[model samples]
Target: MKVMKVAIIDYNMGNLHSVGRAVKHVAPGGTQVEITADPDFIRHADRIVFPGQGAARDCMRELETRGLSEIVREVAKTKPFLGICMGMQVLMEFSEENAGVECMGVYAGKVNYFKHLNIAHLKTPQMGWNQIQQKTAHPLWTGIKDAARFYFVHSYYVEPTDQSLVSGETFYGLNYASAIAKDNVFAIQAHPEKSAEDGLRLLANFMQWQP
Candidate 1:
């Protein structure tokens, strides 16, 4: 039996153990989940899960310092790529964080800090569970109901120029792109690993997704 390999990119941003375990749990039998920063390993994997935390500037710097920036861009174009949190944010053209930072530019968008919330109860980071409204039907959302709640922890959110790329949206102070998909790449602002059953189902769908 052949073993499919899933690479969880490590760029010194945050711990990948939870993401690794979640992927391994949902992966079909004989699938290997490796948490690595090695370019060769990432290039050879059947799928790539890029989960990140911390500041965008720091994360991008780490990827460049380790010579993994180009590799990530290449992988996104050719393979089944899933970007979580900061991983998804960095795909944009630029970020307003750290006094403005340039990202991979894979997607034409900008990451902006949450602003102008009239509601006193809402927070900037938008932490905890939030409902995701499916903007469009896709394989990654299979078996997951519309408006499913997912875990989120970020002060900045992505605003893609092209609305068609938005696969899901969530509202806090306003409706923002919670999930974006283009070609073989699908990214979400939420943490599926931390989320419960629906999150697991999404991961399983990604494992079997062909497009």
Candidate 2:
């Protein structure tokens, strides 16, 4: 049987092993998950999983440093792309981290810090399990119940200019886009690898998603 290649992009930002293991765990019998930063390998993969954890400035710097910025932009335009955490933030136009930083600008949005909000006193990162309110139907949310809790660890959240792009929302102090999808690109602010059963189920669905 032929194998489906899934690439977990490694741009020297975060741990790729866990993401790779989760993909492998849910991948069907002929699916192969490769963790790499090679442009050739990424361009040729069947699907791309971009996951990261770090400041937006650092992440973008690493991507450019490794000469993967354009590669990522190209893959995102044509493949079933999944961006997690910092991966999701980089899709926006700019981030308010490290004073300010320019990003991939795939989506017309900005990443903002979750501070000084006059809501419930929540921590800055909004870490731990949080319920994801499904805003629209998508293959990525298949079999996943509404308000399913997922693991999140971040001090900033994505605010897309087009609200229709938001596929999921979660309330830390205020309701913010927890997931966004457009065409072949789907990004989530949470970490599916550490998100347990529902998270694994989402990954499994991604493995079979035709889009």
Candidate 3:
């Protein structure tokens, strides 16, 4: 049998060690997990895990600087691709960040910032644990409860043109599409590496996921 190979795309940004460790911990014994920016290896891998953080414009710049933007869009279409945090946000066509920035365009959407909230307590960069209300059934949601909380640290969230693509939603100041799924692509705005039990389960499910 062919051993499963997972590529954690490296663009010289985000928490690579934590994301890599989390995936390795949950993946089956023989599965291979490689952290790479190389296009050839990435395209050949059976699965792809994209984890990112920091500013939206910077993220796109790095992906482009490393010549990985198009490669990511190409492989995502044919393989089981999982995106996390800023990784999820950049899948959109454009973003209302740093004036404006074009993205990978894997999905028809825009990444919007969390505007100022009326509540004195609520704020942008919705850091900490928040519940993810599953909007659609999916393999990534396996073993995780409907309202399970996941770790998140971001000021922007994605808005897909197609509501049917949303697999999960969360409310900071208002409800937003916190997760999306379609064909071989699945993305979440939460940080599964930092999340505890339920988060690990989600990673494990990704390991066995066929889609």
Candidate 4:
């Protein structure tokens, strides 16, 4: 069998070390994880992971500056693309957090900050561990139990127009789209790298997921 080569997009926004380490640990031997800024590598990668660690506009700018916008879009179309943290948010058409910046538009929606009646008591960022209520079953959640707690560090959340695209959700003053997948594009608001065992399993599942 050919080894599954995973390309972790090194767009300067990803938590590179942690994500790279986690993929190395969970994936089978011969599965190589490469951190690359090269568009060609990303375009040809068997699996692509778009991990983000900072602001939405900054990340979008970086992709545009590096001329990776269209390349990333092409990769997402054919290969299994996984987005984490701000990476996940960038999959949408726009982000309310950034005001006017456009995103990859893989998913139809806008990412917005938390706002609800019960939100006054809770924190803004919603940092630390939270239970991800699995909404729709996907290959990425195989062998993973329901209500799995994943590490999250974000203030904004995705409000997808297509409800069917949502794969999982979490409550932080309000229920938000924590995970979503439509065809080859898969994304998560939670950080699987910091999520321990279940996170590892999620990464493993992504490695084996065939688009």
Candidate 5:
């Protein structure tokens, strides 16, 4: 059996299919990527991937219903975890989306909608490709460039109270935390599966990341 087991957490609100394909693509022949909702299966994995897309209310609601919320928090702290898109947002203390949401509190911060920013000229849900300015050195960003462009599709952006934890920043209407990292957890507000070359490079890096 492959010793490197990567669990793409399935809380029923994520793009598991795409994310799994992405991970498997970069993963070596000796690595195994499993999409699972079983807590024990996830807890035992070598790496964890928390991926989500859509409203905060639904994401939190589903996680609670499936009893995966706490598991997510626990695994994030214990392993090399990667949170993508809504996965990254929910790691914060709260979110302005869906009329305020109490997040997992993994980080001290909140997610905000672009409309609430009061920048009328700027478009909400800054979709398509955007450049990420690397603010810190990380194993996941091994081969990626400094100002690498990644795929993003969200109206809400995360603002962490601890700005020092931010690994990457992106500018839309304003500069916001596109990625954050501390210890074994690395979270990003972009979808690597749809990000093409650099995105694949990130996943490739994560597969070998010792953190």
Candidate 6:
């Protein structure tokens, strides 16, 4: 069997290893899960996974400092790229998480913090499993059942100016976009690798996606 290389950008954030492990399990053996900063590695890979944690501003700074911002932009514009968690948020133009910071600008929007709503009575940092409401069908959600529960752990979320890009949504203190896709870039605010069967199916679907 042939192996397709999948590169997971390792800019010192999030559970990169877990994402790589999950990809490897679904990929044919000998397929790589490279944790690298080399532009060549990213350029040559069949797919890229940007699994992110921590603050959006911090992730942006690291991408800039490592000169990865330019490479990532080029890669995202042309290849199959997936963003997880904060990885998804930073793909937008800005984030409010740190008094506002400019992001990759792959999508036109700003990241906003979750606010308390009188009706929900939920706390911020809406952690734990939440049901993802599928708004549209795409190859990424091919094997994912509608209203599948996925893991989430964040206080802020992205609000895309392009509603057509939103693939799924979920509720916390309020309803917000849980996943987004634009051209070659695909992202999900939830961690599919941690969501068990449904999440794993989502990951598998992504691995099998073609441009």
State candidate 3's TM-score. 0.97
In angstroms, how far off is 121's CA in candidate 5? 2.5
Candidate 3 residue-wise lDDT, 72-160, digit = tens = 99988999999999999999999999989988888899998777345566677788999999999999899899999999999888899
Q: Which residue pairs come into collision in candidate 2?
A: none
Global fold similarity of model 2 (TM-score)? 0.97
lDDT of 5 by residue, 65-116 (tens): 9999889989988999999999999999999987898999998998988998
Off by over 4 Å in 2: 118-120
Query: Could you give candidate 4's per-residue lDDT for residues 1-211 as a string of tens digits?
Result: 9767889988788689999999989888888689998887787779998899888899999999989888888888899899899888988899876666788898789888774335557788889999999998899999899998999998888989999999999998888899998898889999999998899999989988887
Provide the TM-score for each candidate, comma-separated.
0.97, 0.97, 0.97, 0.95, 0.97, 0.94
TM-score of 4: 0.95
lDDT of each: 0.94, 0.93, 0.92, 0.88, 0.92, 0.85
Candidate 6, 1-211: lDDT as tens digits: 6568788998888998888778777765577678888889899888898888998878988898888998898988888999999889998998887788999998899898886234456678889999999998888888778998899999888899989989999977667899998777789999988888887787787777886
Pairs in clash, predicted candidate 6: none
Judge candidate 4 at residue 151 and give its lDDT: 94
User: How far out, in Å, is residue 117 in model 2?
Assistant: 2.1
lDDT of 1 by residue, 101-163 (tens): 999999999998885445677777789999999998999999999999999999999999999
Between candidates 2 and 3, the TM-score winner = 2
The window of 10 residues in a row where model 4 has the poorest summed lDDT is 113-122
- Ranking the candidates on lDDT from highest down gives 1, 2, 5, 3, 4, 6
- Candidate 3 clashing pairs? none
User: Candidate 5: TM-score?
Assistant: 0.97
lDDT score, residue 76, model 6? 89
Can you tell me which runs of candidate 6 are displaced by over 4 Å? 116-120
